[model samples]
Target: MKGHTIGELRIGQSASFTKTISEHDVYTFAGVTGDLNPAHIDEVYAKGTQFRGRIAHGMLSAGLISAVIGMQLPGPGTIYVGQELSFRAPVRIGDTITATVTVEQLDPGRNRAVLRTVCTDQDGTCVVDGTTRIMPPKE
Candidate 1:
């Protein structure tokens, strides 16, 4: 599960992880993070909103991107330094989400990697798009 070291990374290196948003997942995320927004937790309340239904927390979907950075691309020991994200669409329960991270730049002297991060629903619609900076593990 070791991640690529700074020197080993390259532009275009990529990785991905996929997950289905489930009722249990949404509930647990809400409970754990204490983000009790009705749009994410209350179906009845959500129906009146613009989304017209419950949507998973944007961060929950972002966490999928984190999963890829921590466990797949740069893998274990990666230190997430910064991220900038845009939530493009609602993620409803039962939607399968795929998170992908691709290396866009590598700065070996500073031991950093800049990656293009994205999460797409089953329909291939981008739900989240962002850039992440990380310090890859030093071997």
Candidate 2:
């Protein structure tokens, strides 16, 4: 995606992208965040948990929304100010999840935008929902 400016955005507009959840991503996120929870890394251990198999971390799936904003929309030099998230479903290895962001509100004076974000699996099941606040560069 190309870079964009704050003036380029319009309220109610949206952008979306998809990514496959891999075992490697889960393990790497565990290593990076030190969240070595069995549910995310151990299939055997996870089978005994409520998830019934290895599942990605809630934050890991949520992070895809950040990737969308930082790399796709309002990309490069965008400053994140806040986020609100709700985990709705478990993201399993091999699932193809799509992350979407819609411009909800824009504060032109502050160069900030409020976006409604969501991550959904291949079956159109919502895995995560949230709002993100970001200041896309003026120039």
Candidate 3:
């Protein structure tokens, strides 16, 4: 499927996806990325950290934003170029995260788009927020 071209996009255009963090997901992410940090894998070790329990890898939630951009908005053939992110809160296993992407700005002349990306937990806490730039497929 072709992606939304610049001409078809508008400011405030948005999309999202939600997922519940699970132990298997975290472990799989850790195994694949080789980021076996204690906070993500070792409950006993994590208990001593500021979070007082295990927390999912921050990028796991960030990946959800990618889902929205690649599958929802300027979807399918969209090319991800740049991303800036900030992890605002800890996300634990079993927490549901909703990742949202809104068109905050567009540079049609450059075939560029900047989207406001946010990930919120079930409690409505903003666990992650950032911006991403993409070159939406013109076709």
Candidate 4:
């Protein structure tokens, strides 16, 4: 994968990645991050919550946005500078998510790009929305 240098990027450039959330994905993420929130791990407890069932960790879905920045739009060697995310919906096991990033602004002088990030489910529901700042590879 070849990454774009800051000078090579343009406003409105975009890329996406898709993956289906599996039960194992949720379990592994919870274990790795130590975020054993019942809403993510314990079905019985989750049944009592507003979600009424286990849901994938918000960050796990947000990571798909990071995947786009690091592996697709700017490709490899991208440096994440900042991100602001709003979780809009629950991601259940077996939900396929498509994460997309669009270049909203660019600062070649600073080698930075501002990207609009969004993740949608199979039904086209927006599950995660955010903006991120990244420094593309300096090539």
User: Pick by lDDT: which candidate is best?
Assistant: 1
- Write the candidate numbers in order of decreasing TM-score: 1, 3, 4, 2
**Model 4 over residues 1-139: C-alpha lDDT tens digits?**
7899988888999999999999999999988999998899899999999988999999999999989888888989999999999999999999999999999999988889999999999999999999999999997
Q: What lDDT, from 0 to 1, does candidate 3 have?
A: 0.95
**C-alpha local distance difference test of each model:** 0.96, 0.89, 0.95, 0.93
On the 0 to 100 scale, the lDDT of residue 123 in model 3 is 95
* Evaluation by TM-score, superior candidate among 2 and 4: 4
The TM-score of candidate 3 is: 0.98
TM-score of each: 0.98, 0.95, 0.98, 0.97
Q: Write the per-residue lDDT of candidate 2 for residues 1-139, one digit (tens) a residue.
A: 4556789999888878899999899989999999999988877998999878989999988888988888878777777899999999999999999999999999888888899999999999999999999988667
Total clashing pairs for each candidate: 0, 0, 0, 0
Candidate 3 residue spans exceeding 4 A from truth: none
Q: Rank the candidates by lDDT, best first.
A: 1, 3, 4, 2
Model 3 over residues 1-139: C-alpha lDDT tens digits? 6778989999999988999999999999999999999999999999999999999999999999999989989899899999999999999999999999999888988999999999999999999999999999884
For residue 60, model 2's alpha carbon misses the true position, in angstroms, by: 1.2
| Residue pairs whose backbone atoms clash in candidate 4 | none
Per-prediction CA RMSD (Å):
0.6, 1.3, 0.7, 0.8
